[model samples]
Target: MSEMEVLVEVRGTLGRLTLNRPRALNSLTAEMVRVLDRTLSRWERDPEIACVLVDGAGERGLCAGGDIRAIYDAALVGDPAPKHFWRDEYRLNTRIKRCTKPFVALMDGIVMGGGVGVSAHGSVRVVTERTRIAMPEVGIGFVPDVGGTYLLSRAPGELGTHAALTAGQLDAGDAIRCGLADHFVLSDALGTLVEDLGSASADDVDTLVRRYAQEPPPSVLDTERGWIDECYGADDVAEIVRRLQAAGVESARKAAETISAKSPTAVKVTLRALRNARGLSSLEDCLEQEYRTSCALLSSPDLVEGIRAQVVDKDRDPQWKPALLDEVGPDIVEKFFAPGDDELGLSTVRECDD
Candidate 1:
C-alpha cells in the first residue's frame, strides 16, 4: 500500500474513493478516516461531482474494520487516539447517511465494523457473492459502533441480535435481507458495473445499477427468523441465552455457546445499545450513544485484553474481567451510556431528519 491510504479521483461525474491498504485488508486508520471525511466533504460541495463511489483497492475486501492494533496500542497507555478516531469516523458515518448526492458503495468484499459505516449508509450499496459482512466486536470486547446499533436495531425481527451476539458473517443474501445493502451484483460483473458508473450521469446511476443487479440467494437469517426472533427477543442476555439453548435448533444452541464465549460486558452492553437505538429517532442519536460506549470500552480491561488475545497474541482466549454474564451489573452497563466529559455530540452539533 502507498502512503496515501485512500486514493481519491474523479471519473466524469463520479467521485471515486478507493481504500488502498490491501495488506491490512484496508482496515481504517485515523488518517484514512480523516481523508475519507475530507474527500466526502469536498465532493459534497463540488458541483462537478454529481455522485460518489467508494470501494477497496484489493480483491480481499472493502475494509476489515478500524485499526484494532492501533486502538490496542493507544489503550495500553491511556492515549485518547482511539476516541479521537471514533469521533471523526462517526462523523463521517453521519455525513454518508445524509449525503445529498448519490453516494454509492461497492461493498464487494469483506465489510465489517468501520466498513459498514462507510458503505451501508450510502444511498446505493452494492454487494457481491464475495461480500462477507460482520460486526464481530464482541469477540474483541467491543460494542458495535459507527451507527451499527442503529442499523441493527431496525433489522427484521431479531436477526440483528443474533448477528451481534455471535459475531457471525453475513453473506450478500443475508446482508441485503438485513437491510445492510441495497443491490446484489455478481463479482464478475462488478468491474463492468463500475466502468458503466464512471461514465454515467448521476441520474442514470440507479438504472445502471439495476441493469446489473440480480436477486441474491435465500437469506439464512430469513429461514431462521422464527427461532431467532423468539430466542433473542428476551430483554436479558442470560434469558436470551437460556432461550437459545432450549430452542432445540442446533444453530440456536451454537449461538448460545458463542455468546457465552464473548466478553460478558460487551455482550450485555451491545444488547442494551441495540435496544436503546430502537427508541432513538435517527442514526446520529445512535452514533452519539455508540461514542459513549466506545469510550467506556477504552477504559475497560476487556478491550485491551480482548485485542491482545485475538489480534496480538492470536490466542483467541480473552480473559474478560467479569468472566460471567451475571457479573456484568447494571452499573457497568450504565457507565457506558452515561454522558462523558468529551462527547461525540453528533445530535448536539446538527439534527438529522428521521
Candidate 2:
C-alpha cells in the first residue's frame, strides 16, 4: 500500500502513534483520520495494549490542525471530499473521548484546530513548554469545529469566548490553567516519560504522570480573567467589542482590533454556537452542530478569500463579506446551523457519559 501518514508501534503493553508529516506539522488529512480511528478501535480491544501514547514525529509540533488549503480547494470546486473528511474526523474526535484504553497525548509545539480534536479529549492530556495552541478558524472565515464550541462553552466565565473571538495562542501555563492540559511535562523530560509509560499499567499511568509532570510557570490568563470575563461575557459581538473599546486598556483594545480583523459572519456564528454548546449534553452533540455549520460555511464567500489571503497568497488581508458584524443578524447566523442533504452521518455515540 501507500506509505503511512502516521507511524504506529506496539511494544510490551504500550501502543505508540507518531504523526509522521513533519514537514507539514502533522496536519490531519482524510487518510490520516481514517487510519487513526481504525487503529485506535483495534488497540482498544487488544488485550496486549494497556495504554496508548501519541506524539508528533518532528520538533515543530504535534499538529497544526487540518489542512486548510485542501479544504479551500475542495470548497472551490464544490468537491464532496470536505464533508467525508469532516464527518469521519469528527467521529474520531468522539472515539478518543470514548476510548476504553488509557490514551495519553504528548502535545508539544503548536496544536490547534483538528490537532485539538486529536489531543484534547484523551484521558491524559499533556502539554510542554513549547506548546502553542488555539482554535484560530475564524480568522480564515471559518468557525471552530471538532468540538471547539464545547470547550469554549465550558471555559471559566467568558475566557473561552475571548479565545474564540481573538484566536490567541495560549502558553503552556495558560493551557493548564485554562483546563486544556492535564499535566505539564518539560519537553526535555518527554523521552523519559515515554519510557516510563511504556511499561505502565492503566492504574500506574497516573502515578507516572504525576512523577513526571513539572510545575508550570504562573499563568497570564489567570491575571487577565477579570478583563476577559467582563469584556467577552456578552453574547453579542458588537456589545463585546463596545465593552473592550470602552475598557481603554491596551490589551482590550488589541483584542478588539483582532476581532475586527476576522470575518463578521464567522464572529456572529461562533457566538451563537458557543451559546448553543453550553446546553449540549456531550461533545458529540457539539460535533453534530459543527458538522452542519462546517458544510454550510464552505459554500460562503469568506472561505475562499480567507484561505487565499492567509495561506495561498500570503496577503494577510481577507475582505470579509457583510463587512460589519451588524450586517450578520440572527437570520444569517441561523443559516449556518441548518444542513442540506448530507448530514454528519454519525450514529449516537453517547459521548457525554464519558
Candidate 3:
C-alpha cells in the first residue's frame, strides 16, 4: 500500500517484483530498493508466497543500475548520505542472495551494475539473447558493488579481474559462460515462463526452468580468453596493466587504454578488492568489504572528478587524482579494505555454487 516506484504483485502463490522505471531503462532508486527489501522480507515469512520472480517493466528489460544522477548530486554537494544508500542497497542485495525460497530473475536486456546486483545472486537467473550485462562502475570512478565482488571473484580464471577493470559488456552467451547467468532462453519466452512459474509449485518450477532452458553457446569474446587470463593473472593492478601493455594484443591494448583513462585510484582499489575477495567464503563477506570500500570512495577526489567528466561535464576527459596508476600506491589501496568499526559484517548465508 505504500507509495512505490517499484511494484510488487502476488499472483496466486508467486510474488512478482518489477523494476518500473522504464524511461531510465529501469535504473534503480533508493526508494525502489527499500520497497523491494520490505516486500521480499514479507514474502519470505508469508506462507502464501511459494516463489518470487523479479523482472523489469520495459522492453529493454530488467535494470540499468542505481540512480547515478542522485549519487552525482550528492557528490556535488559533498554530502555523505550516498554511503547510506549503498548500506541499504547492499542489505537488500544480501537478502536476495540468501533468500530461502526460489527466486528467479528474468534478465531480458541491458542488465548492468545494480541490475547485476539484483539478479545475479538469485537461485535462478534467466537470460535471453537480448541480455547485455556489464559492471561499468569503473567508468564513473567506482568499483563494482552490490555483491559484485562475490560473483566476479568466483569467475573462471582471470575473467573477473578483467571484467572488473575494463567494465566490458558481456552478451548473453558470454554471461552464461562466465557463470553470471544460469539459464538461456529467447526474449519472447520470458512472458510464458513467468506465467508458468506463477501457477507452478516448487517441483513444477524446477521442471519448467529445465525444460525451457537451453545450453549457452561459446562467448563472442572467447577468442580473448587467453589474453585475458595471461594479462590479468598478475599479483596487482600495476602488474596487470604492465602485462596488458606488453601483450600488444588489440584487446589487451584496448583494455589497458580503458583502465588508463579511468581514475587510477579506483583501478588500484578495485583490483585489490577483487584479489582480496578471492579468499572470502561467501557473498555476504564480499559485500561487507565492498560496502566499506564504497563508503571510502565517496570521500575520494577521483569519484567526484570521474563523475564530473563523464556525467556532468560530458567532456569525457577526467583529471584523475594520482593520474598514473603507479601514483596510487599500495598503501592507498589497502586502506579501503581496513575494517570500519561502524560497518555491518556480512550475514552468514549458505554458500552459492557457481
- The candidate maximizing TM-score is 1
> What tens-digit string does per-residue lDDT give for candidate 1 at 1-354?
355789998988889999999999999999888888888888888988888999998889999999999999999999998888998899999989989889999998899999999999999999999999999999999999988899889999999989998999999999999999999999899878877777887798888899999988889889999999999999899999999999999999999999999999999999999999999999998998999999999999999999999999999888999999999998889989999899777787653221
Give per-model TM-scores.
0.97, 0.97, 0.94
Clashing pairs in 3: none
**Listing every candidate in turn, what is its Cα RMSD in Å to the true structure after a full C-alpha superposition?**
1.9, 2.0, 2.9
Kindly list the per-residue Cα lDDT of model 3 for residues 22-132, writing each as its tens digit: 888988887888888889988998988889999998798799999887888898788877887887788888889888889999999899999999999998899988889
Alpha-carbon local distance difference test for all models: 0.91, 0.88, 0.84
lDDT of 2 by residue, 52-135 (tens): 888898889999999899998999899978988998899898889888888999999999999998998898999988999899
Deviation in Å, model 2, residue 151 alpha carbon = 1.3
For candidate 2, which ten residues in a row score worst on lDDT?
A: 345-354
Among these predictions, the greatest lDDT belongs to 1
Runs in model 3 deviating more than 4 A are 1-4, 348-354
